[model samples]
Target: MTKVVLTVDDSRTMRDMLRLALAEASFEVVQAVDGVHGLEVLSQTEPDVIITDINMPNMDGFGFIEAVRRDERRRGTPILVLTTESDAAKKQRARAAGATGWIVKPFDPAKLVDAVRRVAA
Candidate 1:
């Protein structure tokens, strides 16, 4: 089965970038504007992986991760954090919140694809 991936970010450009990369990597893409919208999208479609931004308007990445972990259906889904923040503390918090991995912003598309492939597998 083809892997489906959810890319959640407030920025259209970021979502588009991830879409292009994942598409080339042969994964189906689903987009969401923020964490709230992402959760709604998740309810309708179960993606193999979720790539989300840390800071957003309605709900932040941390909150989203917490929610996903709490949801029985989404608990095992691999969630990768895509953010500009490189602080170790922030990474630690994200890890504690159950993020599968962290991808720093201005990411290399190839690396991103590989990471997603690895996590989704």
Candidate 2:
């Protein structure tokens, strides 16, 4: 079965890049503009993996991950934080908030696909 991935980011360019990469890898892609929209989309779809940006307008990735972890149904779903920030403290924080992995911005298509495959349930 084709894996489903939800990507949440504030940048249209990022979203488009992600969609192209994942789609080319044969994964179904769902997109949201920010954490708020991510949650809204999450309620409607059961994605195999979720990739989110750390900085967003409403509810950053940390908050989104925390909220997802709070839900029993989504507790086991793997969330990958993809952002420009490479701070170790922020990475630790993301892990605490329930992120499965971290990927920096300007991600390589192959690596992104690999990470999704490795984490997707």
Candidate 3:
């Protein structure tokens, strides 16, 4: 089955890049503008994996991950934090909030696809 991935980011360019990369890899892509929008998207679709940016308006990735974790149906879903922040503290914080993995921004397309495949359920 083709995996569906939900990507949440405030940057339109980033969202477009991700959509292109994942779609080229044969994965179905869904997008949201920010964390709040991400939750709204999640309500409408069950994605195999979720990739989110750390910094966003309205709600950040940590808050997004926490919110997802709070929902029993989504608690076990794998979430990958894709951000420009490479800080160890931020990574730890994301892990605490229930993210399955981390990918630094300006990510390589192949590696990003690999990460998604590795974590997808």
Candidate 4:
């Protein structure tokens, strides 16, 4: 089965890059502009895994993760925080918000794919 991955980022370039990488890995990719859009997309698609950027316009990754976890059906969905921020405090915050994993930006496609496979397994 083709695993679906939802990627949320404010950068168009990053979103395009992610789509290319995930698609090359044979994963079905769904995208959103930011955390708010991410939630909207989530309403329609139960993706196997979710990758989101921390800083966004309407809502941030932490808020998005918390909202997702609030939904009983999506509480277990693996959420990977993909962002440029390497702050330990932010990582902890994301973890507390229910993120399953973290990946720094300018991510290695192979490692990102591996992380997704591991978590989505």
Report RMSD (Å) for each prediction in the order shown: 0.6, 0.7, 0.6, 0.5
Give the worst 10-residue stretch by lDDT in candidate 4: 56-65
> Which of candidates 1 and 3 is the stronger one according to TM-score?
3
Which residue ranges in model 2 land beyond 4 Å of their true spot? none
Per-residue lDDT tens digits for candidate 1, residues 1-121, read 9999999999999999999999998899999999999999988998999999999999999999999999998888999999999999999999999999999999999999999989888
The local distance difference test score of each candidate is: 0.94, 0.95, 0.96, 0.96
Per-residue error (Å), model 4, residue 12: 0.4
Q: Give the TM-score of candidate 2.
A: 0.98
The residue pairs in collision within model 4 are none
User: RMSD in Å for candidate 3, one decimal?
Assistant: 0.6
Which has the higher lDDT value, candidate number 1 or candidate number 4?
4
- Misplaced by over 4 Å in model 3 are none
Clashing pairs in 2: none
Clash list (residue pairs), candidate 1: none
For all predicted structures, in order, the TM-scores are 0.98, 0.98, 0.98, 0.99
What are the per-residue Cα lDDT tens digits for candidate 4 across 45-88? 98999999999999989999999999999989999999999999
> Model 2: how far is 25 from its true place, Å?
0.5
